[model samples]
Target: MEAATLFPARAIRLRRDATIRAGQGGPVIALADASLQLPGLPSRICALLESLACRDVPEADVQQDLAADGMPGLLRWQALVTKLDSAGLIERSVLTPQGPVARLRQAAVGRGPGSAVRAPAQVKLSRFTAIRAAGGKLVAERPGGHAHVELETAVTGVLAALAGWTSAGDGVAGLSPQLSRAVIDLFAGAGLLAPGSPDDDTEYTDAALAQWSQADLWLHATSRGTRLTSGYGGSYPLAGRFPPLPAVRPALPGPRVELPRPDLEVTAKADPPLTEVLETRRSIRAHDPAAPITLGQLGELLYRSARIRRVFPCADGQEAADRPYPAGGAAHELEIYPLITRCEGAPPGLWHYAAADHALEHVADPGPATAALVMGARAASIMAADPQVVLIVTARFGRVMWKYNAIGYSLVLKHVGVLYQTIYLVAAAMGLAVCGLGGGDAADFAAASGLAYHAEGSVGELVIGTPASESASESGGNR
Candidate 1:
């Protein structure tokens, strides 16, 4: 047989305790890190194996030691080594530098150094969890899968060491080469070991990092289906209780005016086809200052696009109701507040669109800054005049938050996109002009709307008006 050398892989620990009783077969020893319970070994054999834990020993010397200790000698030694190798706990070879260093050299020269140099085997425990079970058995669990392996309670120390409770040097100090190899192999199979380092630098931009708060990022990460553990992907009752539905805030007690509900069937037949509308949709910035959009037109737009077509309680006892646009869990949490700058029939002011009753509830007079913002958008759009109405889309986060967890914000943004597209399509069909703003300052919106920044914040904005025929022609075709 060829000569062999042995060394302990990192983070393998062996423990002997009263719990490890000697049965009819042999004394049982637990390999904690590997979650293995090894039985069938005589007292002499156990003693012989323990002696090899502290340092490297030649194959011949190990065989001699086993024979001297009144054990089955080389045959037993070879069998144990094979078992450990399969278990991933020990290393047997003329070792050399590997891992990161090897990867670097390989990348630079297309090949790594030959197998002449010698080095100690290095191993680290991968992230995992071990839990005690009802029957005194231990269970080892790792991310990404539902499978778990059973282990002996006595070997818990080995798992703890692999979990980083102790340094690699300390954990593997006295572990037999075979035992160490078994632990490594078990963890590697289960993907419970550290991943290999990449040769390239991986970093994120400062702006990208700053865009999302740490808590926000954590919520997004945990809520995603890909990152979530099993039994966490589907919607579940929060704390085993459904929260009460927020009573539709009755049109902020102000000057309330009923809106005209235009006949939907008549409008659909009269308007251009869906395909034509979609193709013709454009962000028209220029408005006819002399002929602002009629108040009736504004009311019709809101009615067709955002008005609650119907409202019914959800079957699951969750405080959710279905609406025109698809919302996560049917939670129609978006609220519209129109800021009119130059409507023909409506006074220039901030008005909330009451969806339940389909009415405009005057909230407040538009501040100078709000008016300036509207005019600035018109100028940016190269419009002849300011838009007739600037719609501020705000989200009532609590409605969705009570039903969803980490994915709540992401869902809200998606709803905003849906609403934006709905508005674009509806405006195109109505032969009206519309522009969706890329972003708006939430703080500025809060100050103008007098709404709390946290509970209800602006998520999007859109400008709408009657496009000047001459200016529209000058702007050329759809863009």
Candidate 2:
């Protein structure tokens, strides 16, 4: 609740979020979100953990308890401490008979307790480190951090003033003597601070790291490579609390229009050869206004490019599905919303593709937000006029998030790209134009559809129509 003023007082306690559950033989330490079993607990370890749970116990008293135990308590208590420290279950404080120097907690999961500062002449926060507010508290973290530290309200100003490399003697915050060591050690251990020495030439020159921005590296690390491995993948942490989202989003309610499904055998002979489609694939930007795309063409494109082909049951009564395009874990999260501006037969509006039934549901009338989307895609592709159809691709995040952890959003992005290629190739084969835009405004899409941003929002965009010319020039990989 308060900034740490000193190196945490040298006392030991369980973290507030951590609870000790006594089992028949396996004693489990359950954090707010997870419970795990670990080794090296003394027979009476639960009693000690119970005491630590209620209040911080002085280090000397703990040693005394162990010493007073059946046998002089070096090995047993040491084992428990080792297990707790490795699992980040213990909150340690540095005490001086009268009071604690600073109460500190290691909030990083899976990362070992941080190393000591080891006196240095000069230190500076790492260039990659970031301090920001999260869940009502200021957290200090570095990209791919091995440790995480919380800052005291006072420490904010302390770290701010010490932004540039500074002497170790300067002392952080200056609120307490222990503040400097604690701050230095916390940041240093998290890879949030580097020594003033010029030994980081390799770090700077690293080709792998050099290509990454701080945010990209953070996402990559947190989603795949970070040291925070406790819940990195699905352990179904919310299994009992929440039900998994259905495999396919139920079709949106709307002014529905049934679409024609082309006979596969007829389409097979009607389409160009695979090699011809691959060689002629183009990112066509401008639509042929004179010969605007027809509803029939649009329906055929949706059917061939995205319609679900099969469904099979999965665990927990959930079902796995097959579509023209592949998805991670059979989680077909991509949904297509076509904004029709110059289509024949279909009125100008925002329509969602009902892949399961091969139909379109008019969800909203085209308006300012839709115009903005079209214009944005035009600008992104440098088109002279809006394409006949702008297909906004969105993901039902819960579909992947419920089944996958850490890499859920990343997998959705991969699906977006895969589906884009699917549409591109299919459109090429159909003798129609399609171009995947580089990016889109998720907020604008949410405004247009009246959809919750987090539940389902645009991740990618594709412009489709009859090409202005048989050959379309490439821009931003429309090729």
Candidate 3:
């Protein structure tokens, strides 16, 4: 009998139409249409179909699991179920005992292509297992064990007396020739003694251990011996220093001092000749306020300095890599914000320039610092006082940290140096002035931008407009 017979007609009419939205703040497509619109989505839908085909799903249970999966925000599940029903991929009937039941057939199981491939698994070695495999092996030793004792107490006295003895026919010398050979064999077996150079004389002498340092003798004893009357030889004591000195310690570090922010003002001088501007570019710390730069000039600086040049697929297709400034690993983590106080043809306000779009996103209109900006940027105050523009270069540490982990901080700092210099050179080449700044209140600046302070911390700042004084060039030249 048909399952529909289990429920009254009224129950069938009570079903509600469900819809799903995909992507945020845009034209949301129907769940069924989305599969056709996106290249790989049909495969995902097929995987979901395969999962359902393996189970006996009741109509209500199907909806519950879909909701629980939390994919609706990205893929509207309820709406997709409705589309599946309309397409005859699934049929629902009233199972009197179970209320509403969904009976999925073979037709639904073969609906779409296969899903995205799974990632390969990684194998790792455990620390304990690795260490247990290595029974015992000394790594290395630190210095300074001997108390200035230059001779080996273990065998030094025996070797010393053997020296200063002369031999006669058939008469034994101070050190028995047999004893010297025995000590050499014993020490060599223990790894403390090694055969001397080929040119070394076989005859025993007082200076047999002359080359050995105090630390070396402590490890193994040296030998002194002479042939007796059966052979015939003599030995003597050499001058010696009783004790050796210890190694010196490294010196202490210098006191720390608060560093000044990067200088950001362009000096007041003829916009250095155009040819010179190209050849001898300088990071100007003063600017020409009388000749305020225009919005076009600002755009040029942003693009030549850091605009995204190209984007391509990274190792995994999950995320893309964008190339803006040259990064060691194409980790373009630095970002820019323009604090526009004065720019011709641009509003006198603050803006966040999206590198991807090369368009400005209006953030807030900080009327004017009417008062001095914190940190005594007198020039910035003069900019606020006389009105000028400041550009901030910030970094999202997480973007870099994702790949480099511990050393990402170093890479980020180096990136800042390259980017700031680019701006400095570009500003000079364009007949404009720029000062790389470092002293603005980061927290306040972050608050004004409405982004997480940590996500976009101010790494450096630049001021571009005009110089503060006319005699600045003469002062700079003298210095």
Candidate 4:
């Protein structure tokens, strides 16, 4: 298409009527030969007049049809039409049968049976060059966007999940994982997954879909602290506000290590039934094997508290990531690593929760003291035995800093709060006792995880099992 010219005369010959062209007379006149020159006429007006000469149709239908063409505001079309009328090139009349109509006569040449003569084509001229300046290329015609109904539905699901609906135990995404996945895939395919640059060059990088999924984890984690008189807890407060503590051993045990392979299945169903165990759940600092928690029970708890709920395809349409929890701006920076000790359902070893697969991958067997060591100075007194398992919530600063600028730290703080709380509530609902440990030795935790000590990821600890009496009191009986 040619660049739009100002006031170009646009002529239209109605396919159903005779051809219309501009005549030489100052006023539009019927033409025998298509040659005309109007005196004292503005060059800009000629462009619009010519555009009107190209098509043949009722002036009312033609004008109304042109008005419906783009995303432009109505005020703009009204102003342009008024300019043409004032220039005397076009006139409007209310015909008894046709209602209101706009037409051109004289200098315009077209033959039709109707007594009323209309502009052959509607000529639209932009009065201000600024109005023609477009933000970007006009979007391509989207054919079969009808099938994109699925995509629309998926986008809706993602938006709903982001809005806290999924975290509320709504089960919309959980029950329809495929739908959620489809939504992300559609967005990626549609080029809607661009990771726009962040304000802070040093902090947040970009808002990619992977980061979005990670943000989901943070959101779901923090959703547990739903009821609050003040914004003291919940995902919002923790966004980059609290730095992660290093992993350290409790006085009673050696420095924390990745534990040994547990006897439980990573995804197995534990005995005493998850439902029953949840009912009997309590914070017991000590565990009695006589209570022998089965493999399936362990898997159920892990899935409920930390499993990946959905994966979103990136803008490139080639990569994908998981969002086990909802995130704000999709800035995910936390990694959940488990320190398993006595769970019958899982091997007594270190494992990473793969949100993508909703499965656990073994990291190491740090031995029996692993739990005690992770709790560090925060552990129960020496008389108290280690709990069944400890979950280490690690933060990867780079993950967040990429999308959010330096202010991305705010997002990280929110991340920690959300993930930790989700662990708390889901555990509580399952009848498992959980505690959000304060400070830990951050340096030691990184060394154990075999990942760098960079700000991209850090440790947030949650010890689960029968909560000990003293530990329960330390929580101010909040359980």
lDDT of 4 by residue, 293-373 (tens): 445555656666555455454442212234546655554556777677677656676777655454566666675344435
Looking at model 1, report the run of 10 residues with the lowest lDDT sum: 100-109
lDDT of 1 by residue, 227-290 (tens): 2332243355353565645526545876987888899889978999888887767777767777
Name the regions of candidate 3 deviating beyond 4 angstroms: 1-275, 316-324, 367-387, 466-479
**How does model 3 score by TM-score?**
0.39
TM-score of 1: 0.57
Name the regions of candidate 4 deviating beyond 4 angstroms.
1-289, 314-324, 367-372, 375-383, 467-479
Better-scoring candidate (TM-score), 1 or 4 = 1
lDDT of 4 at 125: 12
Error (Å) of candidate 3 at residue 150 is: 40
Candidates in order, TM-scores: namely: 0.57, 0.76, 0.39, 0.38
**How does candidate 3 score on lDDT?**
0.42
Report lDDT per candidate.
Answer: 0.59, 0.74, 0.42, 0.42
